[model samples]
Target: MVAPGTLLLLGPLLAALPGLGQGQGQGQGRQRRPPPTQSPLEKVAAQEELSLPQLAGKWFLVGMASHCSYLAEHSHQLEATAVTVTVLDGQSLAISTFRKLDGMCWEIRQRYLPAQAHGRFLLKGRGYGSKVDVVVGETDHSSYAILYYQKGRSISVKLYGRTIRVSDAVVDKFEQRVSAVGLSEDMTYYFPTYGFCDSADEFHILDETKP
Candidate 1:
């Protein structure tokens, strides 16, 4: 029972209405500081001198923390998710996420275009679709990865493991990052260890590819 809010890996970018207003409105006769040039998500540093090839392989989506209302309400119905990352043309990433929706395995494909920064990427939506900024905050190239996704002002942090289970130390690190982003432990949800789907048939694939 996936939430109508979650489009699997796409998160709120695919479900929520486009152009939702963000930032605090300035009241009449009240002075407000100018906004920073970069967003809060952009301020978070990416893995320095990241090697994209090392990130290629199957990874289990073990943890996620987001403030999307639908996900917050239906967090318990989260499904087991897995992703296979492939480096395309030596820079960009071709990602295929597998999960079960209504008991049927499905594949969701996405491409992360490299940004000016080494570990930062961008997922541009098609047509009226919204854009998502992606950053690999931390990764050891073997054991675990902590990634951040932001669309507009909403941000979601994800913890990926080389295997289904990661060490408690890693979980602690993930929680710390989550809290740093103003979210609490209650907003974090862990995926199931079992019932992971390796692949999905062609008919069940949702390709978010650029023409």
Candidate 2:
């Protein structure tokens, strides 16, 4: 069986949920909070003139922040994930993610089609049945990168590092971005630093190629 964290690697399915501002312990008598004037996507901006070559190679999934109810509930079950990037024709991106589920390593391959924006891309298929908007919001192309994923109104932020551990300064920057998107610190989760699956057998690979 595919683990919940595996599904998380592909994309978090969007579902109807309360606003981020609304927290627990608020009763019916408590005043309802007003929603943010700006949507999560609006708060994020992609990097311009993204250098695909510099971004190619292996990177570990270090941290992630999302308001997805499922993720919030299963945060403890997070897995060590790593992604490898390959620049396709200097325009598109070929991504392969490695993670373990049920004692077996699995590899998921997907292509990110370039958008009109230099650092933005669109992901289609993979059983989600809808296009997911992906933006390379921030990355040094060497040490660490912060990416944003959006499907419909749901948005999530991820921090990736070339190594298993990143500096505290990088983590602070990631948290700031997460807050800018209206998500709180409580919604953030750090992935394991060790035991990253570097490869998967042919039978465990799920290749979602696009033409």
Candidate 3:
């Protein structure tokens, strides 16, 4: 079962419609105000071999959550037309995405360094108009951390890996990590259109392998 607070976030996703439109606009207006810029994960991705081509191909959206209701609502509408990751240097990465929502394409160029374990990838970039940190998990054949965004009292999760769905055991372990972070359980939801790991037609593979 999803937590009450999480349910509020998931309500928009399940409905398949944008939610809190006016509220979101107001929030963005407030975000325009200059805030402190320092990221905890900046050092992590830089120290490690955070390669972009290594992240190429299709990635499944396992789950995502954000405190901002507007961002949460927009998340449901997020569909990637194409994702391109390039290793700018030993300590930086350039990520470009063609999204279907606004038909507006954008790219994020980030520099990072290593932080502590837990496979954290710290990053600093200018794309969304602020300093952001992206914490990534250790990479393996099936799973890896995509990125993490943290600002003041809010934090958003972005997990990108080979498949969207995991085995029951893996899901259980991931949930434990999420709970420890004080993130509400129900706040997380998968992108079903992308398909899961066990499915015959995984969106990441199909979309990437296509000519």
Candidate 4:
């Protein structure tokens, strides 16, 4: 079962959409602000080595356990969630996320910078309340992989593969990493494997470029 409250991770960003910001509408005034945030998610240590070439290109987002209502307009069976990481220069990667936000398909781009570790990096993007540290799990750079992101009050764990469907052993590895990060069983949500990412009209890319 999907934990409905996982949408909090996607909160402020989506709320910044038109007519969606905190208290910026007509007739809705004097509203109190949200309380200070202390997230349970802590950054995971980065690995010693990362292959930029092997990590490049598009990868299917098979699963996620986070506080993000990215698919609010559709069900788990509607479409697919995915991303493309283009290796820029030598150390950085251009990450483009394709997901549903505020009732529409959105493509958000952000530059990922190398942090204090080889496998860890800071997300150089706006809209997020703070720096998002992305940690990569075990990978051969060819098949299945796992990604963990933590920042502010958000914890995002994602499973990716060369294709939409993966082996049970692959999913098992992902589940292990999810637990390693302190995500309980109730926080997991597996996006259905509908193979809808290839649908032309189902997704339209938008450039939310950060300056």
Which is the leading candidate under lDDT? 1
- lDDT by residue (31-101, candidate 1, tens digit) is 35468577779678899868999999999999999998899888888999999999999999999999999
**Considering every candidate listed, which one attains the maximal TM-score?**
1
Question: How does each model score on lDDT?
Answer: 0.89, 0.86, 0.48, 0.70
lDDT tens string, model 2, 26-119?
A: 5634346469577566667888757999999999999999979998898888899999999998989999999989889999999998986889
Shift in Å, residue 97, candidate 3: 2.7
Which structure is stronger by TM-score: 3 or 4? 4
Model 4, 1-211: lDDT tens digits are 3454766766766777765655566677544559855444334554446698889988888877665666333344445677788988888889777665444566666788877677777775556455787777567678877877877556778888888888999889888888877776667777756533332232566544545
| Pairs of colliding residues, candidate 4 | 6-67, 6-68, 7-67
Per-candidate RMSD, Å? 10.3, 11.9, 15.9, 12.8
Clashes of 1: 0
**What's the true lDDT of residue 60 in model 2?**
96
- Candidates sorted on TM-score, descending: 1, 2, 4, 3
Quick one: ranking by lDDT, best first?
A: 1, 2, 4, 3
Error of 1 at 60 (Å): 0.2
Error of 4 at 108 (Å): 2.6
Range of the 10 consecutive residues with the lowest summed lDDT in candidate 1: 15-24
